[model samples]
Target: MMKKLFSLSCLPLVLVLLSGFMGLQLAEARLHYNYHPKMLFVFGDSYVDTGNTRIDQPGSWKQPYGITFPGKPAGRFSNGRVLTDYIAKYLGLKSPLPYKFRKLIPQQLKYGMNFAYGGTGVFDTSSKNPNMTIQIDFLNQLIKENVYTTSDLYNSVAHVSVAGNDYNFYLSRNGSIEGFPSFIGSVVNQTAINLVRIQKLGVRKIVVGGLQPLGCLPGNTASSSFQKCNSTFNDLVLLHNNLLNQAVTKLNRQSKDNSTFVVVDLYDSFMSVLNHPSTNNIKEPFKPCCVGVGREYNCGSVENNVNKYTVCESPTSAFFWDLLHPSQAGWHAVYNKLQTTNAFQQIRY
Candidate 1:
């Protein structure tokens, strides 16, 4: 019989009691449950990234990034943890170590590894970071070396997050708005290919994040005084999400037995939080907790100790931590809503 994990009701108390410690022991204890995964493989961009980007990259490795979590810069692209941290928590597992740090701590390998790099996408972006294909190649190489046995993979789940960096690159490169649908198709198709490759490499289940409402990001909402989302951008985002959903459904149908692909509806979950801020306890749905002092600067901008970015009085009340990413509170709310849906169940044994 499968042992039951810690109940959700105990989370608040556990956090409070373990405030002094790193608190991973509670997560490990919770994983004693039967259906829980033994490992979690992460790929793709900043949304699920936990310090995979290089130290030379100022975007993630600088100050104000991990201010809300580890209380210092920790290479996460948010004021605290991103979606990856929440997902790991949900699975009763410690957040996976980044691929860049895998060799430094061999003991952490049992929880799996993260190949996500901030500012990366399915294809190469302006950041010149490793693309999704290369990220998977890292895993493949490790598997080839017998770092993870077939059984380890059979008991694991893979999470993929490709959060709009490709579209940003496409638009910035003067790609026509009219060709957006075709571009989305290409992205989803390549994502499907990556998913299949992971399965073939031995992963049992894969969770792919659908695009969030791009219009609702602080970068888009700034012009509207953070009061409303740009409908045109949101419409384009909807097209991407719809296509992605179809692709995931097709992948599941083509799978040998049970559904192997799951789509986390980031669109709906983001829209829900933004549309019903009161329900989610978000005081400012579109306003970012961090912003630039001028158009030339952005979150975490600091030059010679002259700070160009300002942090909000309370990051916990704001939905966006920066122009593009969600605050820790924002991700927590979205994760709560996700638990109420069937998406997460697709990965369970």
Candidate 2:
């Protein structure tokens, strides 16, 4: 009887050990199981903007903007969802409500909030929208009002998309080509400061987007007949990305905790899809799905009930939806490539 009792106790211990071993195996198979974030905070420009721009904004509130997804214009810069939507989906959460729409839908506040504004950047751009610093102030106000508890921030991830609007603004204002490197350094430095600020604000994970290949955008490729990317522009983008990577690395090392920052390599992701279009099912990789009828117009331009922009028959076949933004299909393809990297994994837990 004594021997039997001892064996029974041993059985429970053995079972516990076996179960733990199985759990370890499962974790190895799926690394993200333990790192689920309760909410996502979005910042920066149009690449991640989802309905934050005003209804009067010509870029988003017009036809052919959200045509692919919502079947009408819904303030998304893309024809469908943008990068934020896909990233939210990957994390098993609904896309967070835009800051402008948060009060309108109080129930959706649990998912988090998006402070990104289209055509805005780290500094004041020509768009006259809130800069990134001011966007964070909006979050700070919410925190002060107890809209988000400390626990909410601790379980949240911040996604920052500073995708070259500052550069565009600089160049448009006749910024010297020779001084471009210094300008890029300043941009990256300020971005690093922003990332650190977000971390200090209680976000456990922060993902800063690397600049995409600026030369590959349809706007830049127009001179090349949308046939080839300008190597010079892409080289400048590489310098920006390199500086960003180094900054992130240093930030991680300085942290007393685990890795607090990650970079979404938009440059490599864009180049991969554009260079090997067939693999991504993109037929016209360089050409945009939407284009203006004239130089003064753009996608979604309409005057007197007459549309000035024309759209391709199949938006899914084209990599670019317009001059600067990606089509729904284009973003989906890029998201697939992003998953293959450790960008998502770093943010997990």
Candidate with maximal lDDT: 2
How far off is model 2, as Cα RMSD?
A: 4.3
Lowest-sum lDDT 10-residue window in model 2: 27-36
Clashes of each: 0, 1
Tens digit of per-residue lDDT, candidate 1, span 88-107: 88888899999989899989
* Candidate 2: pairs in clash: 35-349
Instruction: Give all TM-scores, in the order shown.
Output: 0.89, 0.91
**1-349, model 2: which lDDT tens digit per residue?**
9999999989989999999999999987686556699999999999999988888777888888988988898888888989999999988899999999878999999999999999998988945579999999999999999999899999999999999999998998875567899999999999999999999899989999999999899998999999999888999999999999999999999997747899989999989999899998999999999888999999988889999999999998889999999998999999999998987667665
The lDDT of each candidate is 0.87, 0.91
Cα error, candidate 2, residue 129 (Å): 1.0
Task: Please give me the total number of clashing residue pairs in predicted model 1.
Answer: 0
Q: For each candidate in turn, give its C-alpha RMSD to the true structure in angstroms.
A: 11.6, 4.3
**What residue runs in model 1 are displaced by over 4 Å at the alpha carbon?**
1-33
Q: Which stretches of candidate 2 lie over 4 Å from their true place?
A: 1-32
